[model samples]
Target: MQVTFETPDQPDVHALIAELDAYLYSLYPPENVYALDIASLLAPNVEFAVARDAGGSAIGCAAVVVTPEYGEIKRMYVRPTARGQGLARKLISALEEKARAQGCSVFMLETGPTMQEALALYERMGYKHRGAFGDYPEDPLSVFMQKVVA
Candidate 1:
């Protein structure tokens, strides 16, 4: 699989994000789902990327939004058929690298408690539990994490 910085509005990438949105909505209430929409992903401060298979099919995607304080991860999703092969790790690493290149040493993200696999992956990647930051209010359904890259 190949992970590269790309536009999120492409057809295949849009499909991937839509699938992710449906899954998240199924698992959480609207207020608990803080995913960035396509237009938001296209913002100047956001860096989005997609993971494609050898045949060039978009199978996974992620984005990092740069803020004055830290890089915030958003819209990270890997298709179900493409899971268990480290695609999520690859996508996240690519975004982190992009952030690091831009001089962002700290990374933060907000996920849901019900997403066990996502929580485990974040923990394995050295993300520690933290309180809500930015404009996010303290919500019981939210899990906030942060990582500092050297």
Candidate 2:
């Protein structure tokens, strides 16, 4: 597997994002969903990356919206077939490294409680529960977390 920085508008990336969007919307109300759209991902403040398999097929993707205060994780997803192989961790680590390079030591993310595995992963990765940051309104369905990189 190879992970590299890439634009989010590619065909395969769009497919992956579409799948992730569908899955999230299915699980949560539309108002509670906060995944960034293509335009948002393409904005100057966002950095996106894609993970490809040995065959060069896009298997996963992640992004971070960088700010002076913190880097907010967004659009993190791996195809169901690609789960359990550590791709998610790799993608996140890459994003953190990029954020650190840009002078950010804090990382924040908002996920849903229904995603037990994701919440567990974030906890294991050293992110502690926190209140909603940025423009996100306080919502019962949202679980926010933060980590300060050393």
Candidate 3:
């Protein structure tokens, strides 16, 4: 899968992010979904990446936020039929590249313990468990992790 970084105004990108957000919300409760929506990912410190097929279809997307302390990952999703094809890894790699370009030294993410596959993927990608940060409360369903990006 090829990952492409595009402007927020790009057609279908925002909608795709919304679809991914909704999918995540359905997996975990709304209260446990800590990250903000697509508009939030467009902040000065935030950026997004889209994974497209060889024919140029938007098959997946992920977002990254660069902070002074670390890089935070958000909104990673591949189409239902696209699972197990390494698209998630591509999206993640693109996000990490963007993070490193912005001088971020570490990467953080908040997912859910119920999402075993996602947790495994993140761990395999070098993200280690971490305490909740930002506005996240001590919710049992929430799982936070971070990676020191090279």
Candidate 4:
């Protein structure tokens, strides 16, 4: 597995982001979803990564939002058909490593309340439940989790 980081403006990066957004939209109605789009995740503070096969075709991607204190995982998605092969975990480890290089000591993320598989992945990856942070309001539909990356 190869994990590569790049500015979201890259063509391959944009392709992954488009696929991610389309997948997310298929999971929920646009009005009911809180997912970020390609442009939003391309903001200055956000660093993105792509996990590729030996042939270098992207299989997964993650966005790590850097801040002075901690980092937030955004737009993390592994193709549904690619689940159970550790692609998601690879994307996560790559992002965490990049975040650490950026001086971040903590990692946090939010996922839909009904995403049991994702929630399980977070738990298995060492993230613990936490109260809402940042612009996230305490809502029954959202689950917040965090890890100490330092």
Cα deviation of 146, candidate 4, in Å: 1.0
Is 1 or 2 the stronger prediction by lDDT?
A: 2
| Best candidate (score: lDDT) | 2
Residue 117 in candidate 3 has what lDDT?
Answer: 88
What is the model-wide C-alpha lDDT for candidate 3?
0.82
Runs of candidate 1 with Cα error greater than 4 angstroms are: none
Q: Lowest summed lDDT over 10 consecutive residues: which window, candidate 1? A: 90-99
Worst 10-residue lDDT window, candidate 2:
117-126
Model 3, span 1-150: residue lDDT tens: 688787655677767767777877788877677766656777888788888888887888888888898888888888887788999998998889878987887898988888888999999999999898877776788898988855
TM-score of every model versus the real structure = 0.98, 0.98, 0.91, 0.86
Off by over 4 Å in 4: none
Model 3 segments beyond 4 Å from truth?
none
TM-score of candidate 2 against the unseen true structure:
0.98
Steric collisions counted per model:
0, 0, 0, 0
Clashing pairs in 2: none
Flag clash pairs in model 4: none
Give me the runs in candidate 2 sitting further than 4 Å from their true place: none
Candidate 2 at 144: error in angstroms? 0.3
